[model samples]
Target: MFSGEEQGKVQIYTGCGKGKSTAAFGLAMRAAGCGGRVFIIQFQKARRCGEHESAERLGINLAQCPQGRGSGPCTSPCPLLTAARDILKEGGADLLILDEIMAAMRHGCLSLTEALSLLETRPAKTELVMTGRGAPQELVERADLVTEMKKIKHYYDEGLPARRGIEF
Candidate 1:
Protein backbone atom coordinates (compact mmCIF):
# COMPACT_ATOMS: atom_id res chain seq x y z
CA MET A 1 0.00 0.00 0.00
CA PHE A 2 1.30 3.41 -1.00
CA SER A 3 1.57 6.04 1.64
CA GLY A 4 -0.98 8.87 1.74
CA GLU A 5 1.80 11.23 0.73
CA GLU A 6 2.50 9.23 -2.39
CA GLN A 7 0.38 10.26 -5.32
CA GLY A 8 -0.12 8.48 -8.61
CA LYS A 9 1.48 10.15 -11.65
CA VAL A 10 2.68 9.39 -15.15
CA GLN A 11 6.41 8.81 -15.48
CA ILE A 12 8.23 8.19 -18.76
CA TYR A 13 11.78 6.99 -19.40
CA THR A 14 13.02 7.60 -22.93
CA GLY A 15 16.01 8.39 -25.13
CA CYS A 16 18.71 6.31 -26.90
CA GLY A 17 20.46 4.84 -23.91
CA LYS A 18 20.14 2.04 -21.42
CA GLY A 19 18.73 1.88 -17.84
CA LYS A 20 15.21 2.91 -18.80
CA SER A 21 13.74 -0.51 -18.13
CA THR A 22 16.19 -1.06 -15.31
CA ALA A 23 15.03 2.08 -13.56
CA ALA A 24 11.41 1.06 -13.98
CA PHE A 25 12.20 -2.37 -12.54
CA GLY A 26 13.98 -0.75 -9.62
CA LEU A 27 10.89 1.30 -8.93
CA ALA A 28 8.73 -1.80 -9.11
CA MET A 29 10.98 -3.50 -6.60
CA ARG A 30 10.75 -0.52 -4.29
CA ALA A 31 6.97 -0.46 -4.61
CA ALA A 32 6.76 -4.14 -3.85
CA GLY A 33 8.95 -3.67 -0.78
CA CYS A 34 6.45 -1.07 0.41
CA GLY A 35 3.67 -3.65 0.18
CA GLY A 36 2.27 -2.19 -3.01
CA ARG A 37 0.88 -4.42 -5.72
CA VAL A 38 2.85 -3.93 -8.92
CA PHE A 39 1.84 -5.05 -12.39
CA ILE A 40 4.12 -5.07 -15.40
CA ILE A 41 3.06 -5.18 -19.06
CA GLN A 42 5.93 -5.63 -21.49
CA PHE A 43 5.18 -4.59 -25.05
CA GLN A 44 7.04 -5.85 -28.12
CA LYS A 45 8.86 -8.51 -26.10
CA ALA A 46 8.22 -12.19 -25.52
CA ARG A 47 11.31 -13.86 -24.12
CA ARG A 48 11.78 -14.24 -20.39
CA CYS A 49 14.63 -12.42 -18.70
CA GLY A 50 16.02 -11.57 -15.28
CA GLU A 51 13.19 -9.19 -14.51
CA HIS A 52 10.64 -11.88 -15.25
CA GLU A 53 12.37 -14.16 -12.79
CA SER A 54 12.57 -11.42 -10.18
CA ALA A 55 8.90 -10.51 -10.63
CA GLU A 56 7.96 -14.12 -10.19
CA ARG A 57 10.04 -14.42 -7.04
CA LEU A 58 8.53 -11.20 -5.70
CA GLY A 59 4.96 -12.19 -6.61
CA ILE A 60 4.26 -9.24 -8.90
CA ASN A 61 1.72 -9.44 -11.67
CA LEU A 62 3.52 -9.78 -15.00
CA ALA A 63 2.24 -10.00 -18.56
CA GLN A 64 4.19 -10.19 -21.80
CA CYS A 65 2.48 -8.83 -24.92
CA PRO A 66 4.77 -9.03 -27.87
CA GLN A 67 3.64 -7.09 -30.92
CA GLY A 68 4.75 -9.45 -33.66
CA ARG A 69 5.68 -13.09 -34.11
CA GLY A 70 9.30 -12.50 -35.05
CA SER A 71 11.93 -9.83 -35.39
CA GLY A 72 11.24 -6.35 -36.86
CA PRO A 73 8.12 -4.24 -36.44
CA CYS A 74 4.70 -5.78 -36.41
CA THR A 75 2.27 -5.04 -39.22
CA SER A 76 -0.88 -5.58 -37.19
CA PRO A 77 -2.05 -4.31 -33.78
CA CYS A 78 -3.92 -7.44 -32.75
CA PRO A 79 -1.66 -8.56 -29.90
CA LEU A 80 -0.90 -5.16 -28.40
CA LEU A 81 -4.45 -3.79 -28.50
CA THR A 82 -5.94 -6.97 -27.13
CA ALA A 83 -3.43 -7.07 -24.29
CA ALA A 84 -3.96 -3.38 -23.50
CA ARG A 85 -7.70 -3.87 -23.24
CA ASP A 86 -7.30 -6.88 -21.00
CA ILE A 87 -4.81 -5.10 -18.75
CA LEU A 88 -7.13 -2.14 -18.37
CA LYS A 89 -10.01 -4.40 -17.44
CA GLU A 90 -8.02 -6.35 -14.84
CA GLY A 91 -6.99 -3.11 -13.04
CA GLY A 92 -5.83 -3.68 -9.47
CA ALA A 93 -2.20 -2.78 -9.44
CA ASP A 94 -0.81 0.14 -7.47
CA LEU A 95 2.01 0.53 -9.98
CA LEU A 96 1.62 -0.34 -13.68
CA ILE A 97 4.67 -0.42 -15.89
CA LEU A 98 4.08 -0.37 -19.66
CA ASP A 99 7.58 -1.11 -20.90
CA GLU A 100 8.35 -0.37 -24.55
CA ILE A 101 4.90 1.02 -25.20
CA MET A 102 6.39 4.06 -26.89
CA ALA A 103 8.37 1.86 -29.21
CA ALA A 104 5.25 -0.13 -29.91
CA MET A 105 3.44 3.07 -30.83
CA ARG A 106 6.35 4.20 -32.98
CA HIS A 107 6.47 0.84 -34.73
CA GLY A 108 2.74 1.13 -35.60
CA CYS A 109 1.78 -1.67 -33.25
CA LEU A 110 -0.17 0.80 -31.09
CA SER A 111 -1.83 3.96 -32.30
CA LEU A 112 -1.37 7.36 -30.69
CA THR A 113 -5.12 7.64 -30.26
CA GLU A 114 -5.34 4.32 -28.50
CA ALA A 115 -2.40 5.14 -26.27
CA LEU A 116 -3.90 8.45 -25.30
CA SER A 117 -7.24 6.81 -24.60
CA LEU A 118 -5.61 4.26 -22.35
CA LEU A 119 -3.76 6.98 -20.50
CA GLU A 120 -6.96 8.92 -20.05
CA THR A 121 -8.83 5.93 -18.68
CA ARG A 122 -6.08 4.70 -16.36
CA PRO A 123 -7.10 4.01 -12.82
CA ALA A 124 -6.84 6.99 -10.50
CA LYS A 125 -4.69 5.29 -7.92
CA THR A 126 -2.36 3.54 -10.32
CA GLU A 127 1.11 4.98 -10.84
CA LEU A 128 1.91 4.55 -14.51
CA VAL A 129 5.50 4.11 -15.69
CA MET A 130 6.41 3.84 -19.38
CA THR A 131 9.78 3.03 -20.93
CA GLY A 132 11.07 2.91 -24.51
CA ARG A 133 13.11 4.72 -27.10
CA GLY A 134 11.60 7.21 -29.58
CA ALA A 135 8.72 8.15 -27.35
CA PRO A 136 6.13 10.31 -29.10
CA GLN A 137 6.13 14.02 -28.25
CA GLU A 138 2.43 13.89 -27.42
CA LEU A 139 3.16 11.41 -24.64
CA VAL A 140 6.11 13.45 -23.37
CA GLU A 141 3.84 16.44 -23.04
CA ARG A 142 1.15 14.41 -21.32
CA ALA A 143 3.49 12.84 -18.79
CA ASP A 144 3.84 14.36 -15.32
CA LEU A 145 7.49 13.35 -15.03
CA VAL A 146 9.84 12.37 -17.85
CA THR A 147 13.50 11.32 -17.93
CA GLU A 148 15.48 11.03 -21.14
CA MET A 149 18.37 8.56 -20.79
CA LYS A 150 20.85 10.12 -23.18
CA LYS A 151 23.62 7.75 -24.18
CA ILE A 152 26.90 9.36 -23.29
CA LYS A 153 28.64 5.99 -23.57
CA HIS A 154 27.65 2.36 -23.76
CA TYR A 155 29.49 -0.97 -23.74
CA TYR A 156 27.48 -2.16 -26.76
CA ASP A 157 29.09 0.59 -28.85
CA GLU A 158 32.43 -1.17 -28.32
CA GLY A 159 31.15 -4.24 -30.24
CA LEU A 160 30.42 -6.02 -27.00
CA PRO A 161 27.33 -8.19 -26.90
CA ALA A 162 24.48 -7.85 -24.43
CA ARG A 163 25.58 -9.79 -21.38
CA ARG A 164 23.21 -11.96 -19.46
CA GLY A 165 21.88 -10.51 -16.14
CA ILE A 166 23.49 -7.16 -17.03
CA GLU A 167 22.16 -6.21 -20.46
CA PHE A 168 19.61 -8.95 -20.98
Candidate 2:
Protein backbone atom coordinates (compact mmCIF):
# COMPACT_ATOMS: atom_id res chain seq x y z
CA MET A 1 0.00 0.00 0.00
CA PHE A 2 1.24 3.46 -0.83
CA SER A 3 1.66 5.67 2.18
CA GLY A 4 0.89 8.77 0.14
CA GLU A 5 3.68 10.50 2.01
CA GLU A 6 6.79 9.12 0.46
CA GLN A 7 9.06 11.46 -1.51
CA GLY A 8 8.69 11.23 -5.26
CA LYS A 9 11.32 9.80 -7.60
CA VAL A 10 12.17 10.41 -11.25
CA GLN A 11 11.28 7.54 -13.57
CA ILE A 12 12.01 7.19 -17.27
CA TYR A 13 10.53 4.72 -19.75
CA THR A 14 12.35 4.80 -23.05
CA GLY A 15 13.32 2.62 -26.00
CA CYS A 16 12.47 1.85 -29.61
CA GLY A 17 9.81 -0.68 -28.62
CA LYS A 18 6.26 0.01 -27.63
CA GLY A 19 4.59 0.35 -24.19
CA LYS A 20 6.48 3.42 -23.03
CA SER A 21 3.37 5.55 -22.73
CA THR A 22 1.36 2.56 -21.59
CA ALA A 23 3.76 1.95 -18.75
CA ALA A 24 3.67 5.61 -17.75
CA PHE A 25 -0.11 5.64 -17.85
CA GLY A 26 -0.14 2.56 -15.68
CA LEU A 27 1.94 4.41 -13.14
CA ALA A 28 -0.38 7.40 -13.37
CA MET A 29 -3.35 5.13 -12.64
CA ARG A 30 -1.54 3.55 -9.75
CA ALA A 31 -0.65 6.92 -8.29
CA ALA A 32 -4.19 8.21 -8.64
CA GLY A 33 -5.50 5.03 -7.08
CA CYS A 34 -3.34 5.78 -4.09
CA GLY A 35 -5.15 9.13 -3.67
CA GLY A 36 -2.41 11.14 -5.29
CA ARG A 37 -3.07 14.03 -7.65
CA VAL A 38 -1.81 13.34 -11.18
CA PHE A 39 -1.07 15.62 -14.10
CA ILE A 40 0.13 14.63 -17.57
CA ILE A 41 1.57 16.94 -20.21
CA GLN A 42 1.97 15.39 -23.64
CA PHE A 43 4.58 17.03 -25.82
CA GLN A 44 4.50 17.03 -29.64
CA LYS A 45 1.00 15.56 -29.79
CA ALA A 46 -2.41 17.00 -30.46
CA ARG A 47 -4.75 14.24 -31.53
CA ARG A 48 -7.11 12.96 -28.92
CA CYS A 49 -6.42 9.38 -27.87
CA GLY A 50 -7.92 6.69 -25.65
CA GLU A 51 -5.78 7.89 -22.77
CA HIS A 52 -7.38 11.32 -22.92
CA GLU A 53 -10.79 9.78 -22.33
CA SER A 54 -9.46 7.48 -19.61
CA ALA A 55 -7.66 10.36 -17.97
CA GLU A 56 -10.82 12.38 -17.68
CA ARG A 57 -12.69 9.47 -16.17
CA LEU A 58 -9.85 8.79 -13.77
CA GLY A 59 -9.62 12.45 -12.72
CA ILE A 60 -6.12 12.85 -14.07
CA ASN A 61 -5.25 16.23 -15.55
CA LEU A 62 -3.91 15.88 -19.11
CA ALA A 63 -2.88 18.51 -21.61
CA GLN A 64 -1.58 18.02 -25.14
CA CYS A 65 0.54 20.29 -27.32
CA PRO A 66 -1.29 21.67 -30.34
CA GLN A 67 1.75 21.32 -32.58
CA GLY A 68 0.75 17.72 -33.35
CA ARG A 69 2.98 15.08 -34.94
CA GLY A 70 5.54 15.34 -37.77
CA SER A 71 5.94 19.09 -37.37
CA GLY A 72 9.67 18.73 -36.94
CA PRO A 73 11.57 20.40 -34.11
CA CYS A 74 9.57 23.12 -32.42
CA THR A 75 10.88 26.65 -32.56
CA SER A 76 11.23 29.11 -29.71
CA PRO A 77 8.25 29.74 -27.42
CA CYS A 78 6.86 26.25 -27.75
CA PRO A 79 3.49 26.09 -26.06
CA LEU A 80 4.20 22.70 -24.54
CA LEU A 81 7.36 23.96 -22.92
CA THR A 82 5.57 27.00 -21.55
CA ALA A 83 2.72 24.86 -20.24
CA ALA A 84 5.14 22.55 -18.49
CA ARG A 85 6.86 25.47 -16.83
CA ASP A 86 3.54 26.87 -15.65
CA ILE A 87 2.40 23.49 -14.33
CA LEU A 88 5.59 23.05 -12.38
CA LYS A 89 5.26 26.50 -10.91
CA GLU A 90 1.69 25.94 -9.80
CA GLY A 91 2.69 22.90 -7.74
CA GLY A 92 -0.39 20.86 -6.92
CA ALA A 93 0.19 17.53 -8.58
CA ASP A 94 1.63 14.59 -6.70
CA LEU A 95 2.56 12.81 -9.89
CA LEU A 96 3.58 14.56 -13.11
CA ILE A 97 3.93 12.59 -16.32
CA LEU A 98 5.70 14.33 -19.19
CA ASP A 99 4.47 12.08 -21.98
CA GLU A 100 6.70 11.85 -25.07
CA ILE A 101 9.08 14.37 -23.56
CA MET A 102 12.10 12.34 -24.63
CA ALA A 103 10.79 12.41 -28.20
CA ALA A 104 10.50 16.17 -27.94
CA MET A 105 14.08 16.33 -26.81
CA ARG A 106 15.16 14.11 -29.66
CA HIS A 107 13.39 16.36 -32.15
CA GLY A 108 14.77 19.51 -30.49
CA CYS A 109 11.41 20.74 -29.37
CA LEU A 110 12.75 20.72 -25.85
CA SER A 111 16.29 20.88 -24.63
CA LEU A 112 18.14 18.67 -22.16
CA THR A 113 18.96 21.67 -19.98
CA GLU A 114 15.34 22.78 -19.78
CA ALA A 115 14.16 19.29 -18.94
CA LEU A 116 16.76 18.91 -16.25
CA SER A 117 15.86 22.31 -14.89
CA LEU A 118 12.25 21.26 -14.65
CA LEU A 119 13.34 18.18 -12.75
CA GLU A 120 15.41 20.26 -10.41
CA THR A 121 12.66 22.75 -9.66
CA ARG A 122 9.69 20.42 -9.37
CA PRO A 123 8.07 20.05 -5.98
CA ALA A 124 10.01 17.65 -3.84
CA LYS A 125 6.98 15.47 -3.26
CA THR A 126 5.90 15.30 -6.86
CA GLU A 127 6.80 12.09 -8.62
CA LEU A 128 8.01 12.66 -12.18
CA VAL A 129 7.83 10.24 -15.10
CA MET A 130 9.06 10.79 -18.67
CA THR A 131 8.21 8.58 -21.64
CA GLY A 132 9.57 8.27 -25.20
CA ARG A 133 12.45 6.83 -27.20
CA GLY A 134 16.16 7.71 -27.38
CA ALA A 135 16.43 8.98 -23.84
CA PRO A 136 19.74 10.73 -23.45
CA GLN A 137 22.30 9.16 -21.16
CA GLU A 138 22.35 12.30 -19.02
CA LEU A 139 18.71 11.84 -18.08
CA VAL A 140 19.14 8.10 -17.54
CA GLU A 141 22.04 8.77 -15.24
CA ARG A 142 20.05 11.29 -13.22
CA ALA A 143 16.84 9.26 -13.06
CA ASP A 144 16.05 7.17 -10.02
CA LEU A 145 14.40 4.46 -12.10
CA VAL A 146 14.78 3.73 -15.81
CA THR A 147 13.13 1.10 -18.00
CA GLU A 148 14.16 0.53 -21.60
CA MET A 149 11.63 -1.22 -23.80
CA LYS A 150 13.72 -2.99 -26.39
CA LYS A 151 11.99 -3.80 -29.68
CA ILE A 152 12.83 -7.26 -30.84
CA LYS A 153 9.84 -7.27 -33.20
CA HIS A 154 6.70 -5.26 -33.76
CA TYR A 155 3.49 -5.80 -35.69
CA TYR A 156 3.84 -2.33 -37.24
CA ASP A 157 6.57 -3.84 -39.36
CA GLU A 158 3.90 -6.17 -40.80
CA GLY A 159 1.99 -3.32 -42.45
CA LEU A 160 -0.39 -2.83 -39.57
CA PRO A 161 -1.27 0.70 -38.61
CA ALA A 162 -1.74 1.71 -35.03
CA ARG A 163 -5.11 0.53 -33.83
CA ARG A 164 -7.60 2.59 -31.87
CA GLY A 165 -7.39 2.22 -28.06
CA ILE A 166 -4.57 -0.32 -28.39
CA GLU A 167 -1.96 1.94 -29.94
CA PHE A 168 -3.53 5.37 -29.76
Candidate 3:
Protein backbone atom coordinates (compact mmCIF):
# COMPACT_ATOMS: atom_id res chain seq x y z
CA MET A 1 0.00 0.00 0.00
CA PHE A 2 1.17 3.54 -0.73
CA SER A 3 2.04 5.63 2.30
CA GLY A 4 -0.29 8.38 1.07
CA GLU A 5 2.38 10.97 1.63
CA GLU A 6 4.44 10.02 -1.39
CA GLN A 7 3.77 12.13 -4.44
CA GLY A 8 3.42 10.26 -7.71
CA LYS A 9 4.47 11.48 -11.13
CA VAL A 10 3.46 10.88 -14.70
CA GLN A 11 6.04 9.06 -16.80
CA ILE A 12 6.07 8.09 -20.44
CA TYR A 13 8.22 5.73 -22.52
CA THR A 14 7.77 6.10 -26.24
CA GLY A 15 9.76 5.51 -29.40
CA CYS A 16 10.40 3.12 -32.25
CA GLY A 17 12.63 0.89 -30.13
CA LYS A 18 11.77 -2.06 -27.95
CA GLY A 19 11.72 -2.18 -24.11
CA LYS A 20 9.05 0.44 -23.48
CA SER A 21 6.59 -2.00 -21.91
CA THR A 22 9.48 -3.95 -20.44
CA ALA A 23 10.61 -0.84 -18.58
CA ALA A 24 7.11 -0.17 -17.35
CA PHE A 25 6.84 -3.74 -16.10
CA GLY A 26 10.14 -3.37 -14.33
CA LEU A 27 8.79 -0.33 -12.51
CA ALA A 28 5.64 -2.27 -11.67
CA MET A 29 7.73 -5.00 -10.08
CA ARG A 30 9.69 -2.45 -8.12
CA ALA A 31 6.56 -0.71 -6.88
CA ALA A 32 5.06 -4.08 -5.92
CA GLY A 33 8.22 -5.00 -4.06
CA CYS A 34 7.69 -1.95 -1.93
CA GLY A 35 4.12 -3.04 -1.14
CA GLY A 36 2.31 -0.68 -3.48
CA ARG A 37 -0.84 -1.75 -5.28
CA VAL A 38 -0.18 -1.79 -9.01
CA PHE A 39 -2.52 -2.01 -11.98
CA ILE A 40 -1.62 -2.35 -15.66
CA ILE A 41 -4.04 -1.90 -18.53
CA GLN A 42 -2.86 -2.92 -21.97
CA PHE A 43 -4.56 -1.33 -24.97
CA GLN A 44 -4.76 -2.86 -28.43
CA LYS A 45 -3.42 -6.05 -27.03
CA ALA A 46 -5.22 -9.23 -26.07
CA ARG A 47 -2.69 -11.97 -26.57
CA ARG A 48 -1.39 -13.61 -23.42
CA CYS A 49 2.27 -12.93 -22.86
CA GLY A 50 5.08 -13.45 -20.39
CA GLU A 51 4.29 -10.19 -18.60
CA HIS A 52 0.71 -11.29 -18.05
CA GLU A 53 1.94 -14.45 -16.33
CA SER A 54 4.48 -12.47 -14.35
CA ALA A 55 1.94 -9.91 -13.24
CA GLU A 56 -0.40 -12.66 -12.07
CA ARG A 57 2.38 -14.32 -10.15
CA LEU A 58 3.32 -11.03 -8.54
CA GLY A 59 -0.27 -10.17 -7.64
CA ILE A 60 -0.55 -7.15 -9.89
CA ASN A 61 -3.86 -6.30 -11.49
CA LEU A 62 -3.61 -6.52 -15.27
CA ALA A 63 -6.16 -6.18 -18.05
CA GLN A 64 -5.97 -6.19 -21.83
CA CYS A 65 -8.28 -4.32 -24.19
CA PRO A 66 -8.21 -5.79 -27.66
CA GLN A 67 -9.64 -3.84 -30.56
CA GLY A 68 -12.13 -5.93 -32.46
CA ARG A 69 -13.11 -5.50 -36.11
CA GLY A 70 -14.91 -2.26 -36.96
CA SER A 71 -13.48 -0.55 -33.93
CA GLY A 72 -11.65 2.64 -34.79
CA PRO A 73 -11.25 6.15 -33.46
CA CYS A 74 -14.55 6.96 -31.83
CA THR A 75 -16.23 4.34 -33.99
CA SER A 76 -17.26 2.57 -30.80
CA PRO A 77 -16.74 2.97 -27.13
CA CYS A 78 -13.27 1.85 -26.11
CA PRO A 79 -13.21 -0.80 -23.46
CA LEU A 80 -9.78 0.25 -22.25
CA LEU A 81 -10.92 3.82 -21.78
CA THR A 82 -13.92 2.64 -19.81
CA ALA A 83 -11.78 0.41 -17.65
CA ALA A 84 -9.27 3.20 -17.12
CA ARG A 85 -11.97 5.59 -16.02
CA ASP A 86 -13.40 3.06 -13.61
CA ILE A 87 -10.01 2.34 -12.11
CA LEU A 88 -9.22 6.02 -11.79
CA LYS A 89 -12.50 6.61 -10.03
CA GLU A 90 -11.92 3.75 -7.62
CA GLY A 91 -8.41 5.04 -6.88
CA GLY A 92 -7.13 1.74 -5.55
CA ALA A 93 -3.88 1.53 -7.41
CA ASP A 94 -0.71 3.13 -6.11
CA LEU A 95 0.84 2.80 -9.54
CA LEU A 96 -1.10 2.62 -12.79
CA ILE A 97 0.60 1.65 -16.03
CA LEU A 98 -1.23 2.28 -19.28
CA ASP A 99 0.78 -0.05 -21.41
CA GLU A 100 0.86 0.74 -25.13
CA ILE A 101 -1.64 3.54 -24.74
CA MET A 102 0.31 5.70 -27.13
CA ALA A 103 -0.05 3.00 -29.74
CA ALA A 104 -3.73 2.91 -28.98
CA MET A 105 -3.93 6.60 -29.77
CA ARG A 106 -1.85 6.15 -32.89
CA HIS A 107 -4.12 3.32 -34.05
CA GLY A 108 -7.24 5.48 -33.56
CA CYS A 109 -8.49 3.46 -30.63
CA LEU A 110 -8.09 6.46 -28.33
CA SER A 111 -8.03 10.20 -28.72
CA LEU A 112 -5.73 12.97 -27.48
CA THR A 113 -8.45 14.60 -25.42
CA GLU A 114 -9.28 11.31 -23.73
CA ALA A 115 -5.68 10.61 -22.94
CA LEU A 116 -5.19 14.10 -21.55
CA SER A 117 -8.26 13.69 -19.39
CA LEU A 118 -6.81 10.55 -17.89
CA LEU A 119 -3.71 12.49 -16.93
CA GLU A 120 -5.64 15.38 -15.51
CA THR A 121 -7.97 13.24 -13.41
CA ARG A 122 -5.69 10.57 -12.02
CA PRO A 123 -5.49 10.23 -8.26
CA ALA A 124 -2.83 12.35 -6.60
CA LYS A 125 -1.00 9.35 -5.18
CA THR A 126 -1.10 7.15 -8.23
CA GLU A 127 1.99 7.04 -10.40
CA LEU A 128 0.97 6.85 -14.02
CA VAL A 129 3.02 5.41 -16.87
CA MET A 130 2.13 5.32 -20.57
CA THR A 131 4.11 3.46 -23.16
CA GLY A 132 4.45 2.70 -26.91
CA ARG A 133 5.72 4.46 -30.02
CA GLY A 134 4.85 7.84 -31.53
CA ALA A 135 3.94 9.72 -28.39
CA PRO A 136 2.26 12.92 -29.35
CA GLN A 137 3.84 16.28 -28.50
CA GLU A 138 0.89 17.16 -26.30
CA LEU A 139 1.50 14.16 -24.07
CA VAL A 140 5.22 14.76 -24.02
CA GLU A 141 4.73 18.31 -22.87
CA ARG A 142 2.41 17.27 -20.06
CA ALA A 143 4.35 14.26 -18.78
CA ASP A 144 6.61 14.78 -15.80
CA LEU A 145 9.15 12.40 -17.19
CA VAL A 146 9.41 11.39 -20.84
CA THR A 147 11.95 9.01 -22.27
CA GLU A 148 12.14 8.40 -25.99
CA MET A 149 13.96 5.19 -26.77
CA LYS A 150 16.05 5.55 -29.89
CA LYS A 151 16.42 2.47 -31.98
CA ILE A 152 20.03 2.43 -33.02
CA LYS A 153 20.26 -1.28 -33.74
CA HIS A 154 17.87 -4.19 -33.55
CA TYR A 155 18.02 -7.90 -34.25
CA TYR A 156 14.84 -7.56 -36.25
CA ASP A 157 16.82 -5.72 -38.89
CA GLU A 158 18.69 -8.97 -39.43
CA GLY A 159 15.42 -10.75 -40.25
CA LEU A 160 14.90 -12.45 -36.92
CA PRO A 161 11.39 -12.93 -35.65
CA ALA A 162 10.41 -11.92 -32.14
CA ARG A 163 11.33 -14.69 -29.77
CA ARG A 164 9.18 -15.84 -26.91
CA GLY A 165 10.25 -14.77 -23.40
CA ILE A 166 12.33 -12.05 -25.05
CA GLU A 167 10.02 -10.05 -27.30
CA PHE A 168 6.70 -10.92 -25.74
Candidate with best TM-score: 3
lDDT of 2 at 96: 91
User: In candidate 3, what are the lDDT values of residues 1-168, reduced to their tens digit?
Assistant: 388998889999998987899999999999998988999998877788898999989999998876532345644568778888888889888999999888788778878999999988898888999998889999999889999888999999999998899987
CA lDDT scores, all candidates in order? 0.81, 0.86, 0.87
Q: Encode model 1's per-residue lDDT on 63-144: one tens digit a residue.
A: 8865332345564655656665666667667888988888777666778888888788777677889999888889899999
Greater TM-score among 1 and 2 belongs to: 2
Please give the distance, in angstroms, between residue 162's alpha carbon in candidate 2 and its true position after superposition.
1.7
Q: Candidates' TM-scores?
A: 0.88, 0.92, 0.93
Off by over 4 Å in 3: 68-75
Report how far residue 88 has shifted in candidate 2, in Å: 2.1
lDDT of 2 by residue, 1-168 (tens): 145567888999998988999998998898888787888999878999888899889999988877787677776867788877887788787889999998788778888999998888787778889999988899999899999999999999999998996988
Error of 2 at 84 (Å): 1.8
Better of 1 and 2 by lDDT: 2
On a 0 to 100 scale, what is the lDDT of residue 71 in model 1? Answer: 45
Sort by lDDT, best first: what order? Answer: 3, 2, 1
lDDT of 3: 0.87
